[model samples]
Target: MTFVTKLSFASGDRDVLAETVQELKDTLERKGAECKGPHASSPETVSVPQYKRLRAGDEFSPWRYDVYKRSMEIHGADDIARDVVARDFPDSIHVEVEVDRKKPLGHRRD
Candidate 1:
């Protein structure tokens, strides 16, 4: 049976995220593992209002930041997937991984 590993990487720094994902893809491919994609989602914009302690008026501007996310799916790469999960990622980047076992057609869910 094959397993699909879904990896989601998020970071405020776009360059770092891109580089990290690219490196991961390269490593997995070099190891003869099948990597599906590093599909990028729309950048998420988060806004935070900065309020001054003394002034309660609506004079403070809100701080806005972008949170970029990239996703990839690796199939039939249990060993590589485990190594990836145990690897140390940069502090700026956040990684999430989910593993799903592939079943035969007759055993699949509707």
Candidate 2:
């Protein structure tokens, strides 16, 4: 069974928020889960190189308190959200997640 997971964050900064998101992604992957989706940032723009590093998992750094909101449509993921939630995020940041118990099938309901 699969489900749609919507992760949201309210932080003091964007840079650090991005880092936290990346770490969460890694953590999810490590726990045998897969995630995918586009991101919406308040800055209105994310550089190309920055995107590349994040995609390649090579741009993690210490950042200020920043809130991150990550919405993922995932598969075969259980307890992953709980574990990720347990991670220690920056004090200046807050993370939230909404998990929808519906698997995303390729077939559309026309």
Candidate 3:
């Protein structure tokens, strides 16, 4: 039996996101754990229209920004994965982790 630790990170600040991911990858690598990736997802554009006062005829350009995401899988490294999930990160960054246990697909014949 083995576990796959899926980690996802998101942030509006690209630099902060990259730094956080890199630090995690480095820690796992230093511990000699097998890591799959820091797979990047397309930036999602988020916009919110700004309205001036309560008037029904006034509106300003929408505030626009991109949110970046990165994902990675850690194979058979439970301890390392736990440490990563437990570690503290910047308040502006968001991190999520999921653990999935895997078993052999077929019955074994002795």
Candidate 4:
């Protein structure tokens, strides 16, 4: 079975989160990590205020939460995972990785 990497985060700034996600995706491609998904997907993103309230938090003192996700298939190995972990990340949020249920079309099978 193939492994994968997922970088995700929650933030109080939706625009920043959006930018980070895009930047990550671009970095993955420019650095040639064999990424896929989201190219044909449109994930539902929420604003800082809306996100807080959606999670049942008070807007006045928002608990600081937002939704952002980026996924890259690791092919039959974990090269993608190692590469992503080696990349630099912004100070505004955190990143976490996970496995993908389906193989990303962009990943090389060999």
Candidate 5:
């Protein structure tokens, strides 16, 4: 059996997001870990409505911002994936991790 760890990162700042992902890719490569990619996604705009008063009689313009996203997968490298996930990231960046267990070809559940 093998494990594939997927990491997803998102942030309002594109520069910081790119930098963080790049650094992680470099680290994984240096450690001889099999990495899939640091795939990037199109920026997404998010809007939030604001109310001037508690009663909401008057409302301000909707606050809008762009969010950037990047993702990568560490294949069959549990130690490297664990280290990367354990490290602290910037407050502005959001990280998500998912692990998938892969069985060898023709393998079946007993």
Candidate 6:
């Protein structure tokens, strides 16, 4: 069996997000891990409505921001993937990891 680790990173700051993702890719490469990519996605705009008071009588302009996302996959490098997941990241950056187990071709359940 082989394990593939998918890592997704997101942040409101595009520059910081890019820097972080590039650093992670470089580290994985240096460790000889089979990394798929640091694929980037278009920024998403998010809006939040603010109120002047607890009541709904008054309201303020909606606050808006853009979120950037990037993703990559590490193939058959459990140790490196684990290390990457365990490492601490900046508060502004969000990281998500998903592990998938793949069975060899022609394998079947008993």
The top-ranked prediction according to lDDT is: 5
- Candidate 2 segments exceeding 4 Å error: 44-70, 103-110
TM-score of each: 0.88, 0.57, 0.88, 0.49, 0.96, 0.95
| Candidate 6, lDDT over the whole model | 0.94
lDDT of 5 by residue, 1-110 (tens): 99999999999999999999999999999999999889999999999989998886689999999999999999998988999999999999999999999999999889
Q: Candidate 4 at residue 98, lDDT?
A: 68
Candidate 3 lDDT tens digits, 26-75: 98999999998899999999998888878666889889999999999999
Best-to-worst order by lDDT is 5, 6, 1, 3, 2, 4
Question: Over the stretch 14-63, how does candidate 6's per-residue lDDT look in tens digits?
Answer: 99889889999999999999999899999999999899999886889999
Write candidate 4's Cα lDDT for 1-110 as tens digits: 45656655544455776787677677667766666643323345553444445575555543344354444344433665676677776776566666665666787887
**How many Å off is the CA of 17 in candidate 2?**
0.8
Better of 4 and 6 by TM-score: 6
lDDT of 2 by residue, 76-105 (tens): 566776666566888866666677776367
Query: In model 5, which regions exceed 4 Å deviation?
Result: none
Give the TM-score (vs. native) of candidate 3.
0.88
Clashes of 4: 1
2 or 3: which has the higher TM-score? 3
